[model samples]
Target: MTRRPSPPQSTLPSDPILALRANELLARGRQLESQGKIADAARVSAELVNVAPDLAEAHQFMGSMAMRTGAADIAAMSFERALQLKPRSADLHIALAQALLALQRPADAARILDKGRTLHPNDAGIFRELGQAQLDLGQPDAALKSFSRATKLVPNDLYSRHMASALATTGAPNPGYVAELFDSYAGTFDAHLTGKLEYRVPQALAAALAEHGPVAGPTLDVGCGTGLVATTLPETLRPIDGIDISEKMIAKAQERGVYRHLRTGDAHAVLADEPDFAGPYGLIVAADVFIYIGDIGDLFASLAARLAPGGILAFSIEFNEAQGIAIRSSGRFSHSPAYIHGLAAANDLSILAEVSHPIRLEREIPIPGRLFLLRRG
Candidate 1:
């Protein structure tokens, strides 16, 4: 998540007249932001930056406004200028790191945060952000150390504590963690998954669906990221409803115009609330979603109750040889076939088909996966 900037701290110009104007503009910008006039606030900040180019606070405020407006590139540039004007400010370094992370440049963010940590070793904020950057770069061990240090520095910080625990234990991460992770990832999810990771589960699930006869009722796509399932499936499954945790991902999915409905929330809670979700779906597809869930027994139960008679529930899992589910350091879960079989039996759902494939490439190594089609009795 992008961190919002603190209130403006103006460095008045030397000239009394210019200083008076700068102070007025600065106050106006703060007032506009408080009143939710983000565009107006951005204009005010831009004007301030123009009038006092040497004022680091003006540039910082400009960057914060750009961040609020979703102009991450502009925010990064503005933050860089702020840092150049005030090299000693830890706040500037932190803001710049946030902009870089928003732009999906984790390496650069990590570098900046590393420097920030050097400059302010005791700052918990720097350690927390540095941990996130490390996690993004696939360095869980390093991230765990960073988060642990943050926890030590600020024991009351729940975010840091939760992150440290998630990395250290074999449990599902907090919903907020998943939401933030995907929100940051939503921009490049498609290309990173399909191109770099060789993700083909969506298309493979589509082909598997073809073997079944016509879908008997409305369909649902649980945890549908970017509408990949809707896009890959045959047009026969139009008007699919979707639920996901990330709003940014939901927005991208909405842009595809394939889904009839979409909402942002935990899939488990939505699936369990049948009256609200009104499922009884003909088909429910969850592509590459189980990796985030450590124990999916409750989810399976919910899905079973929502399926229409003879309805097909299709999903994918990172496969493992162990008897149950296991979460790795990479913050993804892998399930053994035995665990899935037990879920089907407990839910009274019959396994219709199972296909094993490479779900994606992690560090050039294939990650094994299993796609299953289960039918409600």
Candidate 2:
């Protein structure tokens, strides 16, 4: 007769020795994870689960590992199991919500975050996560309220406070906020922007440049998110330099191998970094970049100083033509033609061409905007 092995335990033990051993195993697993030994950590966690199946920490470790591997569905299952074992764990709730969001279940993530908020009313992190979920779910009004409540809970938290205030007022978005937004968004930026948002600014800019017949010079693309602008350029066009605030965005653009160089920093600060390049670029582009910045005088002055004489500066802006500058509810800045052209004139740049170029789709209607090409004196 063959001997049969015992089935694995389905429940944790209450015995002193078993409990102590389980704790030791869990601690070892966590230590391995802390040391960046993910495989070792996973093996240890599996051992812990085999010995003590109801251990939430083991499940949580597996959940985190799954998340890091981009197995969001597995992560969600592990987190849900952990939640069943430890229903009151706020951190588990957050992890589960994050997995759900990554899985494209923003509404479900919002629900999980809401449950977390009910348990921990003062947890600003939960509120922030909830707000993000709401925003992704197209409930911007609800997101604004959640963000406001988060800032109220933690007054000194610059990110939540900035987002809350920026959502409520007409002001330029903080550069850090813009960078942080895009850093998290980099994974889906190209697909979401081009396919869903109907963004054609980069292609439009290329076509506009092409009208000038094989335009070529030392060029710079400000806020070159994923370097989509490079696709529209003529073969004769130079490998343009690029700058962006988000390191993730810069990395994505680098993978495209289009730019002469890519830099991660504030676009305003990059404007001042003369050592990063030769004297001045003959063509400077701000394709959809100025939407994050309201006041243009300072930027125009910097562009004028950095553009060689007779060099070109091309850019785009969302315009309603009602005000010199307006901050939309979406937290983007829009400017009127008067505002941009005034700055160009004040900076001694001549507007060579201005065309109505609407790119983004809102409720199936194109958003009003303009693309302008200017020349330095």
Candidate 3:
């Protein structure tokens, strides 16, 4: 008689009690991760790993926990270990690739996934992550191919949509799409953005203001998000005003009681309508605002008309090349230093100082930003 086939190795419970404890711990770990308690999740997952050393799920959780804590090396180690236990798990391979990508080892990530694709040929998630790895490696063409496959596999994927849009606009003109994306997410702006991103636009603007002389008159806080910058201003700066395109944001700013006047309006148009704005504002501040406005010519002209002679204008801009301003598929605009200088000179403003820093984002990714201080000539 033929011998009965051995039971699947992965089906073993090791011990019923141990399996029950591992399950309980894993559930708690997931809940903690959902609550953004990454440290706690890691701790729980570590316990689960001890109880169920061969469990791929436990190792995957540990990898995710490590990544949340900025422990990329540890995350990579955890993912690699998990892959060894579940060599056929496509999700684990993708997770491993992400960890490798974070460690700036795109070539290694690509190699890992190249093997994974052969083992699990139809996995869309793997292709999507492969695209990201290629993008990180400065191989946009390869990225496009992988992203294309991902979109075909899962048409409604937002991440894939964003990636595709980004690739399409790599060398294209400002198509006015990024603003729409921001406007759509304007409602949940502060809830998802604030501390998670370590956002400190107000602090940066305040520092820029301090470097210049005191604000002798009223001030304008342009694109004032939740009045963060407004509340940070010194009490000596009387009649601080704020303007933004989102009424919901202005309403939130109003709750802070920082601005003497808070209006919901377009920044470019607001200055033009107030033809007599000269004496009211000795300073105009735009923190993390210009990224949405592609053409600074009209905005600068409007600002120049509104400023008192020798009045200072302070703002932050995301940098791009001097030769061109490309609107990314995300619809956000990036400007070059040369473009900024041109706008300042045309508007009769002299650049006093410029400082570059990593701007905080809600997802913990930092983007490059420049703070500029200009005096009306």
lDDT of 3 by residue, 306-349 (tens): 67777888888777655445443233556788888988888889
Question: Model 1, range 247-360, lDDT digits (tens) per residue?
Answer: 999999999988887888888887666465677788888887778867787877887888889998999999988648655535577899999999999988899999998888
Candidate number that wins on lDDT, 2 or 3: 2
> Candidate 2, 28: how far from true, in Å?
35
**In model 1, what is the error at residue 331, expressed in angstroms?**
1.0
Predict model 2's lDDT versus the native: 0.79
Quote the lDDT for 5 in model 1: 71
Residue pairs with backbone overlap in model 2: none
Which parts of model 3 have CA positions greater than 4 angstroms off? 1-12, 34-37, 88-90, 112-128, 144-163, 170-201, 236-238, 245-248, 260-281, 291-306, 318-335, 361-368
lDDT of candidate 2 over 61-160, digit per residue (tens): 8888777655788789989988888878889889999888877788899899989999999888888788778867867578779889988898766566
Residue runs of model 1 more than 4 Å from their true location after superposition: 1-150, 153-170, 212-214, 273-276
What C-alpha root-mean-square deviation, in Å, does candidate 3 show against the real structure?
5.4
Look at candidate 1 and tell me the lDDT of residue 183: 95
Candidates in order, TM-scores: namely 0.60, 0.60, 0.74
- Clashing pairs for model 1 are none
